[model samples]
Target: MRTVFVQIGEIMTRTPVLVAGAGLSGLSTAVFLGMHGTPALVVERHESTSTHPKARGQQTHTMEALRLVGLEDAFVAASPKSRGFALRIAASASGPVFHEILHDTFVPMGHLSPAASADASQEAAERLLLGRARELGADVRFSTELVSFEQDSDGVTAVLRDLRTGEESTVEAEYLVGADGHRSPVRTALGIGTHGSGSIAHNVLWGIRADLGHVVGEEQVLYYLQNPELSGGTGVLVSTDDADRFVVGVGFDPDTQHLDDFTPERAVEQIRIATGVPDLEVEILDRAPVETGMYVADRFSSGRAHLVGDAAHTMPPQGGMGGNTAILDGFYLAWKLAAVLRGEAGPGLLDSHDAERRPVGEWIATNQYRNAMVRTGARYDGPPPVEDPATLFFGYRHNGAVVSEPGDEHELLEDPNAPTGRPGSRAPHVVLDSPDGPLSTIELFGREFVVLTGSEEWERAAKSVAADLGVRLTAHRIGDGLTGPWAEPYGVSDDGAVLVRPDRFIAWRSPGPGPATDLERALRSVLAR
Candidate 1:
C-alpha cells in the first residue's frame, strides 16, 4: 500500500511527523524519528541554528538518552572539559580566598547510568543535533515557519510559509510536535495555559571575549563573582568553549537600568569591575534584550498536536536543566511515536507521553525556580533545603497507562542510589560479557521492550511471549551470561522477571517466581492488546 494520502484534487504530502522549530528539542526529535525510519519534516523560522551561547549544562540523564541513538560521542567531543561544576564564591575573580563551594565529580547518582553529564553551550549542541538530523534523512527546512495547524482524529494539517520566497503550502502529518521555544505560537494556538512562578526575576546576559587567565587562577566552568565593592555590578562570568569567551550575567532592574544605555563600553566596565581586573578591556559580543522566567504548561498536548521543550516547560538556567530536559523530552517520546506508527502500540500509548513527562517538567521548573531563588538571595518557601538532585534527575517515573497496574503505590520518583526494579522507574544499568565484547544493560534497551530474568526458565518464557505478540521485544538471562549481583538492584529473584519499556523505564515486574501466563497477561495489558 502507498504510504500517503490524498485530499480533493491535490496530492497532499503525508509525513509521519511534523516538527515545528529547528532548535535543540525540535532537531533532536527529528533526528530520533529519522533514525527509526519515521519520516519527519521540521520547520524553523530562523535561517540557521543559534549562535548564542545560552544553556551550558548537559545532565547525565540527558546524555544517556542521546547515547541510546548513537549520538553521545558527538556531544562529548563538543562539550567543554568540565570535570565537575563548582560554585566558586570569591570576593572577586582577581582577588580573594573566600569559601569555594564544590560538589562531587558530576556522575549519574548511584552509578545508575553509563553516560556522563557534560557541559556545552546550547549553540554548540544545536549545531551537532541539526547535522545529525539532516544526516538521518530528516527534511529540515530553515527560513520556513508553521503558520497554523488544524488537528483531526487521524492527522494534523499544518500551514507552512517559506520566509524567503513568500511561498505557502499545506502538509498532512500523522502527528505534530511543537518544539518551538517559549512564547510558542503552536501552544498559543492550541490554547494551552502555563502556570507557576511567572516572572521570578530579571537578569541581563552579555557575551564577552577577553583574557581572564590570570583572573581565574583555577579552571572552573562557572564563576559566581561577588564583588559588592565594585561600582559597576557583580554576577557570573561563565566559561563557554574557550578561556577567551564567556557570557557575563548580571541582575537587571528595568526601573533604573535602561537596556539601550547598557552598551558595549558599559558591559566592559562591569566585566572589569566584577573580575577585579583593573584595566581589563573586553569586547561585548552580544546581550539578551529580554529576561528569563520559569513556567510549565498546564497541558502537554491538545488533540493530535503535542508540545515539547520550551513549549511544554521553561525553567531557569540553574542545574543546567533547560536544554538537557528538553533533549530528554524528545528521546522519551520518539520511540513511542515510532511504535504507534508501526502499529506495535495503540494510539492510547501516546497518552503516556504527557502522563509521564508533564509532572517531571513541573518538578524541574520548580527546582530550577528554587535554585534561582537561592542564587539571587530571594526567600525560597518551597521544600525546605531542597530535595536531592539525584531524585530530580534519574528518579522520575512514567506513571501512565503504557505500563501494567502497579503491585503497589510506588512513589513518583525512585532513589537513584538504590534503584528497585519497580514499575515506572528507569531500568538499572549492568554490564555483561557478550560475544561481541562487554555491553551495558542500558545498551540493550532503546529499540524494544526487554525482559530480563535471572532464571533460564523465565527467560525462555519471555521469549515465547514476545514471539506470540510479534512486537519488538526480547529477553536476556543475566546470570547465565556471567554478571554482577544483577537481580538484587532490580529486586527480582532467580525466577522473577523485569519488563522494561523501549524508553528503558520499567513497565512491570515479578518480584519472585510467577506463572508464565502471568507474564503474558501483564504484557498484553501494558501493550493495550
Candidate 2:
C-alpha cells in the first residue's frame, strides 16, 4: 500500500502505472498493460528508441509472450535467415577452430508451441512495441526522465522532468515500475541492494559494419577470437540483423589498459586481426565500455514500486537470457498490476511478483555468471553444466496463495516435455482444432481468466462462479471452439476443469466433479479477495 500526495498549482497527470526507463522491460510493461486495457505512462530520458542493437536473441518463451500480442510473425520476419548453426572458438574468423562449442541440427518446435524462437535486434523489437503501445493508448514520452518518487499507503507520487526543456511536472500513479537498466537510479533511491558476482570483467563493445558473408559463410556463428595481438588475448564476433553489420566484444584489463587505449586506428587494426583479414574495410557504428557481471536485487518490489529487467537482475552475456528475462519480468508484473488496479484483486496479490520472479532472476543470473566464467576460460572450482533450452524457457513453477493445491517440496524448474498441468505450473500447450482452423491452447489466454473443460457442468459452474465473483472469466468447452484431448495432459479427468490465469499459467485444476463452491473458492484465493 502506497499513499499519494500533491501540491497546489502543480501540474499532475494521473495514470494507473508510471514506468521509468524506455528499454525493453519498460516498453514491454507498457505494451502488456495496454493489452490488458491498462494504459501506462512511460518516461525515457533518451530522445527515442535504442539505436544500438543491444540484445539479439529472443528465446522461445519470449516469442510466446510476443505471440500473445500477435507480434511473433513480425519479429521472425525481421530476423536474419541463417543457413546453418555454429558456435566455435578460433584464433580469428578465417583461422583454424580451436574448439567447437555447439554444432547441432536445429529443429523447429511447431508441435510444442505456436511460436518459435528467433533472433531480432532490440531496436527493431522496440520499434514494433512502441507502435503497439501507442495504438493501445499508452502515453510514451521521450526525452523525459523520472526525477524522483515517493510512496506511502495509497499510491505513488513522482516528479518527471523533460530533459530537452528542463521543465518538471508531477505524475500520480497507482504503481511505479523501474526498468531503467543496470545502473538504475530508481533502485538506488529505493535502497535496494543487489547480490551476486558483482563484476566478472570489463570489455569494450564495438558495433561495426562489415561484409563478412564470404568470410564467415551463411551460418549463424559466434566466433570467440583467441588472437594474441588483441587485448586480453580474446574477443567475440557475431553477425547482426543487417547482412553487412556485425558486433565485436574485446576484453580488457582496467588495471593496465583503459578506454583511451582503444583508439580508432587501434580498433581498425584489432578488427582486421580478429577477422584474419589484413585489408578488410570496416565502419565503426558505435563503441562503449561494458562491465560484464552477475547481479540480482535482494527484492523485486518495495511497497507500490517494482523493478523489472536489468533493474531487477543483471548477468553476463553468455546465456542470451538477459533481454528475454526482462521481457518476462514485464509480462509477469503487468498482469498482476492490472488485476489489482482494476479492482479484480486485492493488494496482497502484488506480493506475488517478488516471490515468483526474484527466484527466477537469481537462478538465471547465477547460471549465466558460471557460463561466462567457463566461456572466458576463467578458473572455477565448480563444474558448469549446460541447461536444456526448453527447461530454461518453459519450466517455471510457482507457489503460494494464488495457486490452489501447491504441494510441498516445490521445484523451481520442471521438465517441459513431461507436461504437468499442476497448480502453479505453466499450462501445457495443446493443439486444438476450431472452425477457424487448428490453434494451440496457448491462444486462448492473455486477456482474462479462462476455464478449459469438456463437461457442460464444469462450464456452467465456471459461469456461476464468474457471476458470483464479478470477475472477467471465460469458459470454453473442449469440444466447442477447441477440439482435442486435453484432460490427461491437463492432469484432469474428462469432467474436470482447469483454471488458467491471463498469463496462461495454471491457477487451479479440479480432478473430477467437485463442489459448487470449488471454483469460487479458488478464484477468491487466487485474487486475494
Candidate 3:
C-alpha cells in the first residue's frame, strides 16, 4: 500500500474551499473547484479507498457529471454496463415471479461526431478525467478527521485530527462544504434537521462475488420468489467488469423470517432458492447487513456552509439514486462556490445550491419510496402498468428553482425513450468533432459556462456574452454531418442554440432568431451578475 502524508503543525493556511470527506461527492467537488483555480482541501477519515461498494449504480446523468470533471471513463470502467432493471416479486405462496425487464442501450460516439469511435473510447475518457483532476492540484488528505469548525465573516476555521499520529491542527477556508455521509458532523453542528420518514424496514444486503455460470446470461436479472413461510423478496444479478465475478444483492427484512433468516447463510440460501437451481454453486466472497433509510435534509445550505451527497439527502437502495444524486449535488454546488471564490459571482449564488438540489432530492426520495412500495407490494394503486423499464431511468424532469418553465405535468420518462438533454436538465452525452479529435459533449463541459450554439447567429451572441461576463466559454456550431437524433430529442433544431451552465444544465436556449438577452441574465442569476 502507498501513502501520502501531510506534516502536522505545518499550519496550512486558508484555502478558498474546505471540503470534509473525500468520497465521491467530496472528491468530485474538489476536482471541480481545482479546475477553476480555486484552492480546495479535502479531508477524509478513512486512510484509503473504501472497499464497501454500497452504491454501484451510476445513471446517465452521473456519467455526464463525471465527464465534466474528466473521469467519465474511470467511472464507466468501475460500473457494469447495465441495460435496465429487472424486477422479481415474491408472493406469499407459490414460486417467484419475474415481473419486469427493462432494456436500455448506451449511445456510441459516431452519432455525435465521425471522430468519436466506440473502441476504447469510454476507457480513454475516464482516464483523461481522473488525470485532469490530479493535474489540477487538489489537496486531498486521507486518514484525517474533521473534529470541528468555526465560521466568521472573513472565513471558516476547521479543526482536523490526524488519525495516524494523534495530532490536531486547525485550517482556515473561505467556505466549508460537507460531503460526508448520512451521519454528517457538519449537519449536526449546524443544527440542520433531516425531514422524512425512517427506513420502511431494516434489510441486510448480502453481496457475493461468484461465478453463477452462464445460465443467468450476461444481462442483469432480478428474481422475486414466493414462499409460504417467508413472504416475497427480490434478488439482483449484476455483471461486473470481471467476467468471472458477478455481484449479487439479496434484500431480507430481519423482522420477518423471510426465506431462512437475515443471516449470511440465510442470504445465500435465499439466492439459491430464488434462482430455483439448487445444483448451481456460488462462491460467497463478502457480505454485510445494510440499514436502509430515506430522508432529506431540511436545507442544503446555511450561511457559507453547504451540504452535498448523503449529507443533503439519503434514500433507500431500491431506487439506486443515492450515489447518482450525490454526484449531481457536487456538480451543482462546485461552480457556484468557484464563482464566489473567484470574485466573479456574489455570495447569494450559493443559495441556489439548496434551491436547485432540494427538489431533486425530494423527487428521489419519493421515487425510491415508490420503488420500495412496488417491491414490497405495499401500494399497488398508481398509474397503469407499463412494460418499459427504461422509463424509470430518464423520465425525471428538473422542476426546481433552476427550471423556470417545467412545461406540462408528466410522469417520469421510461428508459431508452427518455430525452437526451433539456433545459435545466442534465446535458446528454454526445460525441462531437474537436480540433484535436473526437470529443464527448461532457468532455467540453465544466470549469466554466459553455454556450453550445447550433447556429452562427447564436455563436456570435455566445462570444459577446462570454466576453461581457469575463468568463471562459466554448462556443460551437452544429455542422451538417454532426446532427443526430439525440439533438432533436433535446428540442433543439438545426438553427437553435443552448447555453450550458458550468454545472452542465441548460441555463438558456434560443431558436436562433437571435441570442436571448435573458441568457446572460440567467447566467448572472446562477453565477454572479
Best to worst by TM-score, what's the order?
2, 1, 3
Q: What TM-score against the true fold does each predicted structure earn?
A: 0.91, 0.95, 0.75
The global Cα lDDT (0 to 1) of model 1 is: 0.77
Best by TM-score: 2
Better of 2 and 3 by TM-score: 2
Q: Model 2 lDDT vs. the true structure?
A: 0.84
Could you tell me the C-alpha RMSD of candidate 1 in Å? 2.9
Clash counts per candidate, in order, are 0, 7, 13
Cα error, residue 504 of model 3, in Å, equals: 2.8
| Runs in model 3 lying further than 4 Å from the true structure | 1-10, 79-87, 90-95, 103-133, 207-211, 214-287, 379-447, 452-465, 477-498, 509-522
Please report the TM-score between candidate 3 and the true structure. 0.75
CA displacement after TM-score superposition, residue 447 of candidate 1 (Å): 1.4
Whole-model Cα lDDT of every candidate shown, in order = 0.77, 0.84, 0.62
Question: Tens-digit lDDT track for model 1 on 1-529?
Answer: 1164436455355778999998889998988887677868899999999988778767777887778667788777887664455666555666573555554336444366767666667888999888888888788889999998898888898888999999878888999999999899999999999998898656677888888877653365565555665322347767777768878777677767778777777777777777778798788887885566888998998787888999999987766688888888888888878878888777877777788889888988888887766654556766642457677777877888444454657457767777877788888877677777777788778777888888787888888887887777888887666565677878787678888887888888887788878888877777666
